[model samples]
Target: MIRRMTDTALSEENASLKARLAETEAALEEAVEAQRRLESIVGELQREKFAARSEKLDPEQFNLPLEDVELAQGVLEAAQERARRALKGDGATGPRAPARNRGHLPKHLPRIERVIAPESTLCPCGCGEMTRIGEDTSERLDIVPAQFRVLVTRRPRYACRRCSGAVVQAYAPEHVVPGGLPTEALIAQVIVSKFGDHLPFYRQAEIYARQGLALDRATLGSWVGRACFHLRPIVAQMRENLKAADRVFMDETRAPVLSPGRKRTKTGYFWSVVADDRGHGGTGPPVVMVHYAPGRGAAHALRFLEGYRGRFVQCDGYSAYDKLTAVERPEGAWQLVHCWTHVRRRFVKRLETDGSPIAEQILHRIADLYAVEKAVRGQPPATRLAARREHAAPIIAALRPWLEAQLSRIPRSSKLAEDIRYTLGLWPGLIRFLEDGQLELDTNPVENQIRRIALTRKNALFAGHEVGAENWAMLASLIATCKMSDVNPVDYIAQTLRSLLDGHPKSRIEALMPWQFRDPSSLAA
Candidate 1:
């Protein structure tokens, strides 16, 4: 009986020990998970605050909105030639094309025999006759700002015979507003001036005042506001089309707003979404859009991508994207591809701070990768990916040991050391780009687009209110995408505004997209 009781006690002790071991393991796992979340948050903050400042690009690298002074000489020359033709009573046929010459000089430059007076003239060198040795004459290119012309439409009145009622006129074309002062051309000017030129409405008003046109800022704002409202359906279609794309690239920058209750109204965000509609054989339109939100959060993304069941989204390592790691519909739908440039940027900053030779070498290798990218400029994503894998993958693989070695030697407190550590942390995501050709090495394309807004932001500081900022976003979306697709901003804005005013139905708004309407031949000019 004593022996049996001893065995029971031993079994009970073993069970207690087993339960304690399980509890300890669970606690350890929880601690590890918490540490990971904290580290992730810290890394995200580092990426947002510190990463991009390392590689500063020249402002000229981006084509910021053209100031009047920056128009190309040839373009201005063309415009001037047209104006001269118009002033000379030549219509749009353009002075009859100056008839092509059969390999002969024009009469203007024909060689002329010199008139000589034997007794009156002598060469300065005391020769028998003087000769012209390149006269000091100059040819100057000149331009004039576009001058406005008015067209008046007259309708005749007729009286009905043997009737008291009189017929005054025929019905007017449906789209044009009766007695409206603004013409399609004038409306186009306003659109391009505000969006392409980034001149605020008030500034544009001041400009018009200089020209003796007393247009109110409020009226100009009303025109812009109405123009954007007219195009909102198209803009909405663009958003939907962008999300429908299998791949999208996104980024955001600050947009300020003015709220009456708030002490500072200049804190808001504008989100940009860019997608290559051509990627999935989407011949409809290549879409790019900007959405203004009160704050920057995953909800903004979720709203933009609400109906999109795309395969992947490529963005920098922003925590907002972490929320979409899995979803029910579009099974295998959302894969997050991080940006290598972001990772490299962290190390680049560190290298600059620490003056590390190894970091420099790694950067040189990255430069080589960029060189390859430059060489394959017009190649499709798949071909580019293949080329990158063949040339860049080996270098990236070779980098692992170098990175590990540097991390070991560097002190943790050093900024360069933290950069290296952060970079290594993102190794799996960064290197994943090498494996998929569709993915970009960096989010620079989207970031490149954002730089324009950043500059306008720098100049203007912030928008007036949330609605005003939203208008800025809508207009920027259309104007920027038009610029990207090689459509003339002036022509497109004018045409779109005219169409919408002329009773063009909003149901087929996608047809108005710049990419859709872009004639390839027009792009060459």
Candidate 2:
């Protein structure tokens, strides 16, 4: 009886040990999963902050429009031109090196041929006048520094001798500014120089003065105002076209506006609405419409997007955007897709400030995502979706638990913890791109448009008034659209003004849109 009782106790203990072992194995599996998930999510968090390598904006390297490197190149070219002119003026014509692949001049520039016949057209052997032969041609670029000449218009009144007062002078040629001094071409040059070339009106006035013309800053501004009045319809048309797109990119930057009584410049804002189908392999031409507002309030942004027909909008995770998605609207609610670049930027700052290993890890992983994005760019949506599913899905899946685990490891109250939480909060929107290949991984395209506006704001210093700010917005929109459509802002504006002055039907303004512009030469290289 004693032996059997002892055997029963031993059996019970062995069974208990086996059950405990199984429980431990299960716990170990869970821990392993958590570790992997933590890494994956952390990587995503970092990537969301840093964005892609190509999209990285370094002010030192790429201040854009006004980049230091470009400025240096211009200075060097000017100096080279001066030296060449001096050497030529000295009249020391020497033998030139034999030409080898040297006749590649731009086809657009007008060529002026100058023949340099041999001294007496006589042969070295005293043979009378050498027989005519084929000539060797060479090209040298030359510039006629903007010669300002007045266009004199004479309207002669000729009353018929045999009939009633029939005074006519072939209706004075049309001008962008009726009865105004500056012609459409001149106005176009001012607009291009100011916005496209980033020259302020005062600087332009100085440049004109150098050309022996008296154009004050105020006079220039008036011309711009007159042109702006005529361009209102076109700007409105551009807005309608942009809003009609199925997907649009939205971004904003601050501008300085002169205050009436504050004795200081008041802050204003510029919003850019971009519709670029080329990045996604869509056939429609890309366009951008710039809008100016007095403040950076949600109201301004919402108003910018008011009556927006597009269902998908890509933008930064600004609080103003909170009012966008899941809200009632005329066209129902639209989906708000967050920008991974904005998210990645935060971690980039973190990594720069303190070499956080987790931040580094996340940035590297995000780079992986960008690599996938770059390869699939300009490809069909189905291809992008397949690539993301095959590659990005596994990374994101592994990221979740890893991110959660890292959160536990770090100090609960630290900024790292905070960043991770912020990233996790936006996890749904960030990961939403995994299914939709139509969406971009970031807002780089639209952000790029904002750079031009930034250049204007950075240089122009400030707008004189709210009206002036509006003009900047209007003109900048046209210039930005012209660039996207491959049309030269100066040529397009000049021709469009002529068309308007010649009475282009208001109802047919669509024909004047940048992409619809008729003259191919007006398109820039």
Candidate 3:
């Protein structure tokens, strides 16, 4: 009887140990998942905060809104699957993802059909063909590889033998590059490839060579320079149009330029001045004017903003921008509207490195502001302002005291303290979004424009000269604007070149804007 009781006690002890082990393992898994998520958030914020130039990732590197959405979607789906399994006594357990809203493939896309048939359609018993039935179909996206094509232009000459008159032939068309081997369309492709797709000229030449065309890089680049030279007026006009807006966004990225004889590169800056009002339901086309400056200093910013008509300019916390607020303005007082995204970035960095609870709380509060912005986006300024007053103002009112309290608790010399101080320092500008609904909560729009410049800069490594950099800026601006307007860069560039060569009137240059672009049956001077 004592041996039987001892065995029972040992069996019960073993069960208790197993139960505790399972609980411990689950807790470990939850901790690991939380850390993983924290690391991902920190990494993204760090990349944005530290990778100052080219602002954020491009596809060649990273950053698209789709990326964040897809990530969240994937995590949510996995959690839901786990929850479903766990309800039936599975090991995994976690939060389920929110309901998904998905879209079908575009109906406008051309459908290619392929019908598969069984080896024998005959019925086994009757040895006769079966009656037709319904079909099941699915679609998968596909692409046709790009290939080079040629256009052989011939102008036939005619003469009247009886009169011995001078032979008559149709005059060859005016080309962007007179008597050049490339057609306007081909030149457009080269410009689009280099500027829009971020493919360099030499890379383009190599691509062409693979297709049995031996075009040299210099030849292709020559076409680009000529096209940009003529397109200069359009880019200049775009800048004026952008400045005409009551508010604009501006950002700058580093540009490495080759020092002609030094055999090294000198650092230059590409300033992106943007005008986009769609977020507040303003009926204006978005424009990006990338200006190349020899340096990123107060002098450059001052000179660039010289003719800007607007008083409000949204940007980061660069000291040069601070000086703008003090500058004399004909339109009234110059205002430096700061970006909340920049403020949040500092705390995100602290969170990742220190795992500070303070940073986490700040991020959550900032997220609340963004959620309110999302609801009022595209609404009228008054509507947005009303919503902000209702939803975001209270959050800000509560956050300020909390920030100061936290600041008082942390060491004054600590990095978190420094970040909190930065927030407090820019308190006015950061909260300015709450005052005006027309303004954005961040300078993401301009940074997004800088992203294109950053990507091409990465691929080309550095511009061969400052002039080359200027040319890059001009073409990139036009192409990016075309994209914003949902116009094909290739078509837009080609049409513009044709019209310009055909002497499209200088007074009508405004009609040549990408958003105003259209194809006509005939183009001749």
Every model's Cα RMSD, please? 16.9, 13.6, 14.1
Q: Which of 1 and 3 is the better model by TM-score? A: 3
Q: Which candidate is the best by lDDT?
A: 3
Q: Candidate 3, clashing residue pairs?
A: 57-62
- 10-35 in candidate 2: lDDT tens per residue? 99999999999999999999999998
Q: Show how many residue pairs clash in every candidate, following the order shown.
A: 0, 14, 1
Q: Cα deviation of 322 in candidate 3 (Å)? A: 1.3
Off by over 4 Å in 3: 1-142, 518-525
lDDT for residue 147 in candidate 1, whole number 0-100:
65
lDDT scores for all predictions? 0.72, 0.83, 0.85
* Cα lDDT, model 3, residue 216: 92
List model 1 lDDT by residue over 63-149, tens digit each.
565654476866888999878877876534433444344335433343434443336557667777666564322232345666666
